[model samples]
Target chain A: MIAEGRIVIDLSRNGDVRLTSNRGADVARLLVGRDPREALDLLPRLFSLCGHAHVAAARVAVQEDVTEAEAHADTSRVLAETAREHLLRILTGWRVEGAGFELPSPPVMGLVKNMQAAVGDPAEERQVSALLAGYLETHVFGISPAAFLKLRDLAEFTNWLDGGPTLAKAYLCQIVAHGWQGLGAVSTQFLPALSGAQLQALMAEPSFTLRPEWHGQPHETGPLARQSRHPVVAALLELHGAGLMSRLVARLVDLAKIPTQMTTGESPVRGQPGVGVVETARGRLVHAARQEHGQLKDYQILAPTEWNFHPEGVAVQALAGLHAVTGRAEGAQALIEAIDPCVAFEVRAA
Target chain B: MCLAIPAEVVAITDDKQTATVSLEGVRKDISLALLTDVEPGDFVLIHVGYALNKISPDEAARTLALMAELEEVSS
Candidate 1:
């Protein structure tokens, strides 16, 4: 005898689960049979940016039936999310710098030059390199420094300082010297500041508070790597703050890291119900599912951008509220950027 | 589909298949699959791996400014 069924999963902040099933065979015949090992593989293509999150959730849903290691699943989800955020930030940074309007200085120019030299296409490299160099002399230095300063203010307010005054000083020196190698070293040095406990907590839930003294002001979100390594989070109360630069940097960084983190092996567990959640470039993203008899019974995703980018309505207010009060365009822009709304990622008009 | 954002074309590729664009401080590599006759410094709304349409940054700023003005008037 053969049987078939389909299940749909929906996710929201409310955390509700609903299931319905229909069987083609008689109850008596079905009771005599064993569970089937049907292959389900349409999950990964959902969102290119959050593919890891979906995979992690699917693994947890499948493993719930057999293993007592639910916590491990959660931990793995967090780590993957952190890694994803890091890569996104890097990619975003590369693209933004590549925009040909915001070079830091000569030192930064040299770095761009080196990248073009290594790119292997002479025509493309020459065009991009010259464009970037020209942009630095005109627009990049004109707007970005002020933008960076405003970002620094937002960072301070959110208690997520970008490496405090010391690292900022070193970063400035590298910028002055065009020492790309030194800049890379300085960036690597800051990674050790993230504690294991903080990473664990971030994976488990949303909103971790720091001490009042350390809170400073409202920081930003989005860039996970910049936020994680931002000096303010460490110096103030040992808590990571959220703000625009942090959020933007986190997503940009994650874009650069994704290609390196792709693993070629099957997940450890593949046939039980589980949950996966990660702090994406936006905020907290979660995926949960239920599996029965080796098939997907239910699946759902809660996107981080949904929480931050709520449209202007009663139940869902836009982040533009605070910006409205500040009356500073840069401040408002900074705040909005921090949300890192992936409207494209959330649209399911189809 | 993919996680991509809308950005203004600060520069265009010679073939126009790709463009350098910016959104806030974050920029991206956008494909010209969804729009026609795009040029430098024009805003384009982007989605997962595709450009959906051309947006006017000036118009966007004007709208936001109007919103701010309305709030001030009400206050």
Candidate 2:
């Protein structure tokens, strides 16, 4: 809700990336004494970007009586939110790329209801799916998602992107134009799922969320990490080595399969201060809470931004060696946007 | 973790840590873990899942008096 701080990529002389961040989640500190149910209801309002995901995670973490139907709905909500998030990025990027498109709002709202329906039942799925596919084809990739997904290599991706002035293609073209292709390279090291005990234990230390670590090493936890196993993402990794292009491609890979993914994946079930690890738009979102008499004794959340933006973390590894990069601050911003922080940030070349 | 706002404690569980707080017209259950000797009428800053601080009546009245004086001076 506020401009937390700035990530200054110093290309002027040092060419170093410095994120002078002033973000603090005092909200969680306040929740220390609140009832678990109150905490659960408030989670959605707290995180505007992924309210459903947050509430779902909180509900699970508190061991609330979540029905099977509710779990499925929550899973679909994550998928829908992710899809909209990707589309919004593409939409905004296209505008920046000088594309004369006029899709003021994404049609994702229509699909939201269906997204909450029972997975695989196909509740209004056909209509919503077609609309989304058409919009992506018409406004984003300039090719069918199926066609984009079928792309086997970088060459194929380039050819498909070369077809028209859609959002992603235009941005990809800009990346190619600026020759910022291989910049912001980071290898994916995903944070494995933690049990309730493990998560609570890890979170016991202060500054754990501020500087999150996975097995004592900083790791990446976003679309790139989630879709690392996909073939196109693998191809991008092979070609670009998890650089800006690979990370961006991984996002598109996520975008491509959203229709199918939204209607299929099931959330994991756990009871007693349960830990729900949902792959939100940003990355791995962990919600952990312990309850006493159905009241929250303790609660904690580890958002993807913490993992990606740690002081000695993925951003440092990904954003190095760009001092001599020509696009300067704008280029730095593109790279940072590729990583996508959950909170507000200001990026400048120092 | 979240944006905290002041809410009035409407109800409390027997444990004294858990309570319901009303914000505007909406009432939600929240934790009172950060403050002690809280009652149904007390105001607290609600966040992620807990109350960060309790707003005392003395502080509120002092702030109100300061604002009133500032308004009179401006007038």
Candidate 3:
């Protein structure tokens, strides 16, 4: 019978996991395996949020000696599903965490009312129910131009009984125009303006951006969760605007972009060492891995939360930026929230 | 890293194990596991689905306030 192998690991923010094996196994032997099933089970758990990434890496490490075509398609499907799940969690967070003000709106209030009713919170139920009615009334008369405009053309239509058609139509036009402008900004001003290759290169290096002091210092992550969606320095200079609202708007816009991408053939690349890097509502997230021999090996994930929530160094920069602009405790908290640091994923191991 | 952070309890359940805490504009559920007899508005260190310790709200406020004050002085 084959002896049981054990590998213990400690992880650093830079996607490096230190592994110590106690079964007289080299990297190759540990990865390739005598009993492939049992050997694969010994890999260390890395970040919980990026379990798919870790598994993919393991597959790569094992397949180093094999052909790429041998990689399992089922595994690729699982990884993509994991990525989708992660994205959904982020979107839910955006609605609940990033856009609390919008909650008072009718459509949102309806959802909240249902949730409260189901949860059996009488006071909350009353509050949400009342809010939902008020939202409907205001939306009908076009009193809330922004709210009316935001929902006018959506499939889930709400009849605002008091809203004037003329006003609602005008507001809708304005909202659509604003949305287009936001998209243009994202495509031309924001994304295209930055050199992807250069940014990726910067990521590969060790720097204060990733390793900052101050234990559990808050940083942001998520699709629309933070200012990371906007090029902070560039936005300050060009847009001359920086705050919670601006950051939230950017994320909502990003949400509008995702469904199309998901519907198209833009999912995570399977089997090969494909990395999905994005500036989430927080700062930045990188998912990279290698798949080999129908198993996962050598996975690495760098999440925005890791950079922002570092115990020491990089957090100072984020804090300094927030302090410079808002200069208040609430403002600092807002900035921290703007980063939306995901501590859950940071400390989790799969 | 998942985007979770430590927050102060603005209110607590009778049992003191669950609490309402605020982070940014959002408020959510937090478990009080690491500290004893936590009260309203006491800061706690939170990470990955758990509150690890009780942090002083005064300290958090002071640190943030100081950052703001320093930024003003510099600007």
lDDT of 3 by residue, A202-281 (tens): 33455423442222243333443332333432342244233343443344334333323322324332322333344333
**Candidate 2 runs further than 4 Å off:** A1-12, A94-98, A109-122, A193-197, A266-272, B1-75
DockQ of each: 0.08, 0.04, 0.09
lDDT of 1 by residue, A1-350 (tens): 11211112122223222222221122111111222222113333223344445445444444445443443333333334444333233223223211232223333213322432434444543444344334322432222222333333334533322233322222222323332211111111111222334433332343322110012222222344334543432332232223333333344333333212222111222222345444454544444444466545544444444333323211012222222232233333333333444432221110
Name the docking class for model 1.
incorrect
- Winning candidate number (TM-score): 2
Tell me, by DockQ, which candidate is best.
Answer: 3
CAPRI grade of model 2: incorrect
Write the candidate numbers in order of decreasing DockQ: 3, 1, 2
* Per-model TM-score (chain A alone): 0.38, 0.88, 0.39
Which candidate would rank higher by DockQ, 1 or 2? 1
Q: Summarize candidate 2's per-residue lDDT along A112-161 as a digit string, tens digits.
A: 55555534566665456666778777776778888888887767777887
Interface RMSD of 3: 20.3
In order, the Cα lDDT scores of the candidates are 0.36, 0.66, 0.37
lDDT of 2 at B10: 88
